[model samples]
Target chain A: MADTMISEQVLAPIVENRAVAPDHVELIISSAVLSQAEPGQFAHILTPGMLRRPVSFSRIDQENGQVGLMFQIVGDGTRWLAERRHGEVLDILGPLGHGFAAPDPTKPWCLVGGGVGVPPLYAAAARYLHRSRPDVIIGARTADWVLMAQDFKDLGLDVTVATDDGTAGHAGTVMGPLETWLQDHPDGQVFACGPTPMLAAVSAACEGRATAYVALEQRMGCGIGACLACVVKAHGKEHAEYRRVCTEGPVFAAKELIW
Target chain B: MVIDVSVSLPRGLTLKNPVIAASGTFGFGPEYSRYVDIGALGGVSVKGVSPEPWLGNPTPRVWETPLGLLNSIGLQNPGMDVFLQEDLPFLRDQNAVVIVNIIGHTVDEYAQVAARMNHEPGVAALEVNISCPNIKEGGMSFGQDPDQAYAVMKAVRQVTDLPVMVKLSPNVTYPGLIAQAVEAAGADMISAINTLVGLAIDIKHRRPALGGVTGGLSGPAIKPVALRVVYEVAQSVNIPIIGMGGIATATDVLEFLLAGAQAVMVGTVTFQYPKRMNEIIEALPQVLHEYGFASVRDAVGQALPGRAPIRGGGQ
Candidate 1:
């Protein structure tokens, strides 16, 4: 099963690196090998530290051979990545992991993202744009924390904003907007990427109402699945088994997840 | 002149080079096949496989430290059946020198895996991993005690005529005692040292960073300790030693060889650069020449006390 997904390790030069939002940097790197990356897949980037930081593809430009990665500076690794300048070469291994499966054209779809998780959903929205306009709900802690709402709007996606502080669109968590979307479109398919609690909430809301898919984040090593570092609980025939997030999925159907 | 890097262990196990992919770091084989030529490696000590499918640990199995990686993956594997059916054929096809690293929760379980792998056509050797720090039972426990370590090696030796290398744990007070015990119990060779037990705190969560709490630390942080263990164990036992712990370059490999290791396994460094082992192998000859060594064999045990004087003035 592992024979099919072939990934390349390339040295990509940063084409553009800038702060896209508060405490968030968007890094666009030019690599012919990684430019073929799909939505929801990620690049395992080498940092100054020991381990590689796994960042999802925020934007994939197949035509120009560029892939953009947007990440919040939560740790030393991301901080090092943020410090990289345009023209600086970064060692990148990608387009890794099983990405979000293409939505059925006949079904309505909604792309829900929270904070740093918004980037991959943006990539998903871009991929699904040719088929149909998906409803995109962008959520964050506050107005300053919200990301890529305008970019979704630029893509002509039906965008909704939610913040915990009520400093932006809808008040409360993304659950408010997500619940309303599920109620309005019972048959809609939901695709989300966010913190564990947010993803759990999204998965619970979609239960028996819509088919949901989620992208998971975990501390990883050897992003190629050799180290067995990034695994998530999965339902099995007898009991719960661990699945490699770097291989079986960074994206999985909500039903397959134990959470 | 071509530098000879080949290694020959007891029971007819021969490697074309001294750089092997350590167990747990490299999965069965296919995980890094996309980036690495499987046949080009000296050998691959595949992830530890038990008799039955093991569930391993819960979420947050790994944490990064300064120049090290802490992992409590708990030896999760698809078991011997899945390995023979799914993983082995791929390695066999690649013509890889396959060293099956076997582990179990009990002495019987260890014997069970050994007996099953005894007849495998493409297997080059069996690396008995009694030193995995992650598992709750039968891992570090077996390697920490001399009697238990002797029993496990003896049981494995009884089950298979295959070349058996018992992996030693560095967490023990005296790793050389366990090494000597295994050698006495009929171990063909030894691989030292397993990851050192370490911990990381998730200050944000106010708890352990890894799900398994304490994890085995590997990478550059543990190299000095590994070198110390290999140097100590080399003085205690006559069996060939396969040394591993944060080996990243050809220079590191030479350090292991000079410290009395017959071969070396590259683990966590592969996580940083998947092609590192191959690169190390390619660079070994020039590195050996620069260090004034005629061959990898000549370099072994040069740093040991009372060994012959440093040759070629390359130190």
Candidate 2:
């Protein structure tokens, strides 16, 4: 937690840049500056362009001083980051924003991630050592889009996959299997990250029966809170107010979100 | 040797230095505290505030262009009531010069905001925002027309005792004429040039990239245009000029100052690095010294055509 102070850190030469799935790549860089990163915290990766691209930390390996960031090649900036070679240094501002809370060790934990959202959950699963293993549910558009299934399996946690086209695990949104899992483990708490609609569905699946947390995505200007570009409608104690996703949260409890 | 970098405007507004954080970039003041010291800046021109709370434009309000950025935030800001209650007090605590940027759809609306601000104790000055390119009827509409610009400045002047600096748009062909009008109408100082109107296409989607369709372009890309306006307007008006548009480094600051600006405002670069203004402020003394000047005033208008050479250096 102490190392979370914002600093311009260097990315150690890329030791690995492998394709994770279609249009997605997993980048591994060594950096001691990001050691305090807990689950759900993201880094603002600087590009040669004007705005810094915010990418969540998929894995924070404190022992080896390595941090893993997975991103899809959606735009020019991401494509630029994907083209970097070994030993090329990148500027990053992070260990930013509030991360997900540490769930109770005695109770079951359910982590629901959709598509690119699947990566951030891996770090949380590895960090949370508990009596019961966590249920990792991933949703993708098709069989070709499913990622990190083997990585979660290697961690020895219970893994579930749901593909929209019926080419993978549950043949629908991950909510179907997630709802079924909730019925059995009714005492579990859920944590989800994905597109807004998926998060809305996950929040609905909890339905006052369980507590849930969700991470939101917004177009950001200054990765710091100054620009007020990445604001979300959040319910405060008195009224609805704008909360910064970069500072207040990228991860917020489902009940507090206006959506 | 310590160099005195302070600057003084006509209305007794004295800044510790010449570098100011431009409006619409630095939020009321607390957001950038984590990275830089707010007190270190000469002044903070806050986001444009209207008479009422504005919800702003839809999603995808910002886009990146080569060496520049296009943003149509539509002057989104909490109204004056919230600003006075919440933002102003925080800025006062920082002890930096607080210049409030105000906008309106009509002349009365602009006057009402200034009148309200006139009663506020901590506000050091009023930057009449007649130049924002994003809004529909009031922004550039008031700026591009000299008659409307004079009327707006005159109305705002009648309401406020505090110093009023009219921020002008670069979109005008004869910004000099507009500067002269505002000066004659009762403007204490002038700030030029606001972002130039621009647009970008997604290409793949075959649609405009910005949600607002068009946005105000800023950054190093518009620095030349900013210099041109500052140079032209400075010769036309006697009031102090606060130059802005695409300013980033200490060298850029020096360029604006030499081009006949009393002070310079930094906008777009703040988005890239929140603490960049501090970096520019810190390096100014050395940069000024390298140009063989002891104070900021010594360099003002050094690049103007008719300026005489200094005793120690040839122009």
Evaluated on CA atoms against the true complex, candidate 2 attains a DockQ of 0.48
The candidate maximizing TM-score is 1
- Model 1 residue runs over 4 Å out of place are A1-6, B308-315
Pairs clashing within candidate 2:
B219-B246
What overall lDDT, based on C-alpha atoms, would model 2 receive against the true structure? 0.85
Itemize residue pairs with steric clashes in candidate 1: none
DockQ of each: 0.85, 0.48
Reference-based lDDT, each prediction: 0.90, 0.85
Q: How many residue pairs clash in each candidate?
A: 0, 1
Over the stretch A28-76, how does candidate 2's per-residue lDDT look in tens digits?
8778877568778888888878888888888889899888889999888
Winning model by DockQ: 1
The TM-scores, one per candidate, come to 0.97, 0.89
